[model samples]
Target chain A: MNFINSDKIRKDFPILQRQVNGKPLIYFDNGATSQKPQQVIDVINRYYQHENSNIHRGIHTLSQEATNAYEKARTTVLQFINAKHNHEVIFTSGTTGSINLVASSFGKKHIHAGDEIIISTMEHHSNIVPWQMLCEEKKAILKVIPINDKGELLIDEFKKLLSPKTKLVAVTHVSNTLGTINPVKEIIKLAKTAGAFVLIDGAQAVPHTKVNVQELDCDFYAFSAHKMFGPTGVGILYGKEAILNELPPYQGGGDMIKTVTFEKTTYNELPHKFEAGTPNIVGGLGLAAAIDYMNNIGIANIEAYEHELLSYATEKIKKIEGVRIIGEAANKASVLSFLVDGTHPSDIGMIIDKLGIAIRTGHHCTEPLMNRFDIPGTARASFAFYNTKEEIDTFILALERALKMLL
Target chain B: MNSIKETQQEIVEEFALFDEWMDKYEHIIELGKDLPLIDKNYKTDENLIKGCQSKVWLHAELKASKIIFTADSDAIITKGIVGLVIRVFSNHTPQEIIDADLFFIDQIGLQEHLSPTRSNGLLSMLKQIRMYAIAFSTKADA
Candidate 1:
């Protein structure tokens, strides 16, 4: 296994150097959004500074340069995810936008009355609500695959949910709240057997692990750049060529048009059919730079280092009395969710923030999952490769002090 | 009964002594523990203050021409904030409750210490209290 020099890695992210309240900021909010490295920030700055113009349909030098760079960013994402074609990668605003694109375009065409859509109970609101809206619109049924006490998706329950009427299956590759890595490869195979299109919400997966669209063979895969240490306004939606061709255009606008007329209009090809407006060109370039930065560190190395951190945090936090860690799935990633016995998650979050530690508390945009657990929410401390054991020590100490004040 | 300014001054004096936020939070938690109980019947959804991370219920009744406000929260710190609010507003005339400027939150530095969401909840609690005062004051006109 390749080892990551975490101390060296931490130096690259400029935001990690700053303090929050009075102390050095220990950012444990990677599941919500990762801190951008200096490389990604510079790429965005360079784009606005030198190469700032709209992509496509430009005859000027800057436009051509911007178009090339933006397309190159698409190619970067294509290669990053190992997608079969460059045009299979469409740049949406973020994961929510990407999911909505698929949900609206593909869902409008394929989903029908009496058809069923299957999603897990642990899905983020982004993944769940779009399908619910689609189901409501089309009079289709939405099915939920339940999780075990350990927060693992029950494969048997998932199998039972799969049927011929199942038109689509959308599941997160990693639960943002629980950190449970779903068996997407297996889920895709089963969904394929049922003749259903599957979309994997990879918002939490891309930063922590390697994601190959060709290997997964998922019909649609969606993720945001911010979650992976890139700019916030951009993300990639990887749809299979044939499936994307079959789906209608999500919006009607300039770039997505092949020809425009009063009565007759033709839409553009593969990825352009989905991306309608002037894209976040600078953000795309920044995302590509982020991809390059992650590649340089090596995702496998990052994953290994993050896993060690997770285990370390889990072990240490569990040793503290009155602290119950939520979501102990057999296979997990870099998120830790916990609740103190006598204190609320909000109070814990507030108390810790005063000590210059940043952690997320609440339903984590997974209200259904919170309902499933029979709790309001949990205090989530998610990690990235740049984080360290010392930061975790500070966080643990802060949490202990917070618990003392509250309890 | 203490005037709003006197109550605000007392709170400012009390919070000024605690240098560490930890000690201040401990003090708030203690205040939460000491908050007087509301009637169980009053703790209903109708009295809920919207936009709180923790569920906070505020109930107000105009008894003997004075507005008595009773509030509760599931979270200790939020309940303590409610206690601070009750200390300033409860047992005052409806018009006095409506007319008074709530300077105590600023004096106690509660708004600065709270997270954005919690501060919004605090504002919501204040809004709810003022709203009850308005309702009762109008009924007095009726």
Candidate 2:
């Protein structure tokens, strides 16, 4: 097992050194978005300073350089997710954009009235809303797989929901609010048997664990860059080559067409068909730099370190009086969601903010999951590789102090 | 009932004693605990303020040409802030409410809650209060 030196890794991120509210910042909002490393920032800076040009359109040297860098970033993403081919990786605005692309294009091609789409109850709004819109448009049926009190999906109930009419199964690889690491391999296999395509919302998963699309055997995998220490407004969607070829272009414009005429226009091949406009060239480069930063630290080391932090925080939080953890899944990630006995989450969040500890306090864009648990929202502290056990200790102390005033 | 300016000055003075944010928050929480909550009948969905994090229910009625505002929030800090807002704006003429400039939130160093990104809906609550005042003032004219 590779051990991560988080203290050394912390130096790479400049934001970690800053203070908030006159105290050293203890950021536990990695699930929302991770802090960018200096390397990624530098790459973004270099792109604007030197290689600023439109990709795939200009014959100038700068354009060629920019295009090479952007395409190289796609290859980085392909290797990062262990994708089969380069064209299989498509750059979208974010995870939401990626899912929307698949939903719209796939729905246009295959879905019809009475078709069923299955999604788990723990899905984030990004994963849920796109499919709901698609279903509403195509007049298809939307089925939800239920979860137990511990926030684990009930496979038996999922099995019962599957049938020949099930067209697509969209689910999160990990619960953003609950920190539940779902069994996507099992889910994909089950969906395959039911003759439905699978699209894993890897927005939360790619940052925390090793995600091999081939191993998962899902038709589509979607994730965002910002959540994984890259620049915002960039994301990747990995689809099987054959499946991507079958789907129609999501949008029509420059760079997405092979040939355009007054008569008829044919769409470009593979990933370009999905990416319709001038892409975020710098964002793609920053994402590649972020991948390089992760490689340097070793993702396994980061995963193991974060798991330790999660366990430490969990055990300490359990000792706090009047605190109930919302998600206690047997297999969990680095997120800790909890509520005090008599205090509202926003109260705790507000109090702790004065102490310079930043944790997310709200429904976390998972209102249905909150409804399932019968709570308005939970205070969530999500850890990343740069976070230390000392930070967790400070967070717990801040939380305890906040609860004292609220209670 | 004190005038809006007097009530705002009094609350600001009270908050001034607490130099640290922790003490200010403690006072706010205490105020929340002692807040005269809105009536249960007014706690329906229609009266609920659209906050992303905390739920706030507000109700107002005119009595003897004065707007009596009662508000409650699920979150204690928000409730406490709401209590302060009510102290300044409640039991005043609708015209006074419509014309009152609320600078006490900044004076008390609680301006962060009023930020658009805070999502506690303190800004929205203030807007709702003004909306009520506007409606009642127009009704009085009629």
Candidate 3:
């Protein structure tokens, strides 16, 4: 195992230096948004300091340089996902926006009345609501693939829901609330066989797993940069060439047009047709830097590390009395959602926070999933590769103390 | 632990009762149970709170000086917590409601025990109660 230099790594993040309440900061909210490394931060700073100019339009030196860097960042993202073409990826604000893009453009174009759209029970509201909105407008029927008590998707049920009427099967590649890693490749295959387009919400999946969209063979994949240790305002939507070609342009703006005459306006090419405005230039560069950092560390290694952390934390926390771990899927990302017996989750979070530990408390943006599980939402401590087992130990110890405080 | 007269006074006197005074508590917990069971029929997209961890239906009404509160949760423990909240706030005078301190929450050591969302719910209950108090206070002002 290549041991991370904790002291060295700690120095990279400015926020990690601060204490919460009185305790040293232990951030376990990586599932929500990973802390950015110094390298990523510095790259962002450097761009603003030296290379802050608009891209593709300015013939001046700064514009050309900015344009090159921006396109280069796109290249970095393309390689990060191992996509077949650079044009396949379109930058949106985040995963929510990316899913909305497909729903608004493709969903509006393709689906007619009586057509079906399928999603899993464990999807975040972002995935659920947009489709619901589209279904209401388009007069399409939205079907859900129920999850078992164990928090695993019933693939058999998903298969049952599919038929000729199924236009799109939108599923979360990794469930945000439950941490269940759905068998998306297989789900995609089943959906494809039924002649439906599949869109995978890769938001929760991208930061933790090695996601190769081509191998998965989904029609579209979406993820956010913020969750992956990049800037917050940027997201990626990767669509297959054939699917990308079929959809009409999403937003009409300056760059998105080929030539705009008052009488008739033509559209631009593949990716640019979707990117309509002054893009998140700094955020794109920062995201590219983060991808570079992750790639350097190696995705497989990061995945293995997260697997180890989740197992280790689960084992430790489970030993405490009255601590019930939620979302115990056989295949999971790096989130540990649980409840401490006889204690309110807020109490657990507050007490632990005093010890300089930060974990997410509440529905995690999936109230329906919370309802499905018959829970108020679990206190979640999600991990990333930069996080250490010692941090988990500190968190577990703090939780034990927090639980006692409630008594 | 207090008698009905005392419970009535506590309800009338404290906004805190609406927060969790009822839940330490039998009257509000029972009232939470009274929360119409939120018919399985109505638990659709309309009733949902965007960030709430569970499906919660919060119902309140003002009678004389007191505001009656009732709620239900799909989750058992949350239902129990709601019962606590409704019991405390269901009956109170506007002046008494505003003047009463919620040390009882500190007494029960519950605010610390609640999950952040539940704490928000606890606060939401308080806000709902206080809003009623303010309304009653205004009615008198009128």
Candidate 4:
């Protein structure tokens, strides 16, 4: 594992130097979106400044340069996830867009009346709603895999739900709200046995850990660039080559067509068929730059350091009276979600912000999960590698101050 | 009750005394504790504000030609926000509410202090109060 020099890492992210509310900002909202490094920001700036052109259209030099840069970004993503082929990686707006693409394209083609689609209790609304819409349209059944009080998925219940009629299983690799790192390898194997294709929402996973799609053998992997320290508008939908070839195109537009006429229009091949229009070219390049930044730091190091931070934070936060840590799965990641007894998460979050501590306070786009816990929401302090032990201490102090003010 | 501007000015002066945001939020929470809660019957879906993270029900009634606002929120900070709104806009005529410029939020530094979403909720609360004012004004004119 490469050594993470956090001092250098902090400097790479310009936002880390900034202040909020007259105090130096302590950003802990990595679950919502990670802060971009200067490298990625510079890449975006350079793209717009120098290589700005419509890709794959004109025979001009600038267009060629743009096309190369955009496709190079695709290659970087392919290697980042260890995807088998180039054409399998489809660029979409974000994780939501990627999931919607699969649900619309794959669901329209394969899913039918009485077919069952399985998801989890802990999925973000982005993962849940698209499948729900697909089920509603196709007259299919949407099944949820229940979780234990610790917020871990009950594998027994999941096994019971899977059948020959199960068309697809969509689950998150990491729970955004709970911080549970799912046993996805086993889950994927089980779904395959039931002849169900699996789509893992890697939005929460890609930043903190290494993901190899071939080893997991998930049919589709969806994730957002913004969550992984890249620009907001770009994301990846990595489908198996054969499965992608079989699915229909998501949208019809200028770029996605092979030949167009009023009478007949032929769709373009694998990746381009899905990428319908002018893509977020700068965002794509920026995402690639982010991937490069992560690779240089080494994902293994990030995972280990983040694990330490989580453990340290958990222990410190657990010591506080009346403070209940929300998720306690055996396996977890960078998220530390909690609620202070008799105090609303928002009230806690507001007070903490005064101390320049940024934590997410809401349903986190997971209302059903909040409903399951019978709470309004949680104040989530998620971490990135650049975050220090000092910052965590400050967060703990701010939280204590907040509790004193509120309760 | 004081005039709307007077009430707003009073709130500004009150908030100005607290140098720390924690103290200001403490004052807000205290004000929340002092809120004139909406009647159980009026706490229906119709009175619930949409944008808040917590459930906030606000009921406005025209009593003696003045809009009397009562509210309740599940979240303390939001309740405080509702309390602040009620203190400014309540006990005023519909025309007064409709025309009143609510600059106290900015003056008290409450606008910058809240999260973007919370700010959105505050705006929604203010809008709902103004909406009630417009509706009552239409009725008064009719």
Q: Tell me the tens digit of each residue's lDDT in model 1 across A202-232.
A: 9999999999999999999999999998999
Write one digit per residue (lDDT tens) for candidate 2, span A141-259.
99999999999999999999999999999999999999999999999999999999999999999898899999999999999999999999999989999999999999889889999
DockQ value of candidate 2: 0.92
- What residue pairs clash in candidate 4, if any at all? none
| Tens digit per residue, CA lDDT, model 3, A1-407 | 75555567677788888787666789998878899998999999999999999987898999999999999999999888888998898989999989999999998689899999998888989999999999999999999999988789998888899999999999998887778999999999999999999999999998888888889999899999999989998999999988888899888887788898999999988889899988999989999999998887778888887898999999998898888888889999999999876555754665566578888878888877878977777899998887889999888877776555455
lDDT of 3 by residue, B16-114 (tens): 454432233333234444556445655555443332544455655567756555566654445655565556656666766677655545444456534
Model 1 / residue B72 / CA error / Å:
1.4
Q: Individual DockQ of the candidates?
A: 0.67, 0.92, 0.17, 0.67
Q: In angstroms, how far off is B63's CA in candidate 3?
A: 8.3
Model 2 regions lying over 4 Å from their true place: none
Model 3 DockQ, alpha carbons vs. true complex: 0.17
Pitting candidate 1 against candidate 2, the one with the higher lDDT is: 2
Global fold similarity of model 1 (TM-score): 0.97
Clash totals, every prediction: 0, 0, 16, 0
Backbone clash total, candidate 2: 0
lDDT of each: 0.89, 0.92, 0.79, 0.91
Give the range of the ten consecutive residues with the poorest summed lDDT in model 2 chain A. A1-10
What TM-score against the true fold does each predicted structure earn? 0.97, 0.99, 0.82, 0.96
Worst 10 residues of 3 chain A by lDDT: A342-351
How close to the true structure is residue A264 of candidate 3, measured as C-alpha lDDT? 94
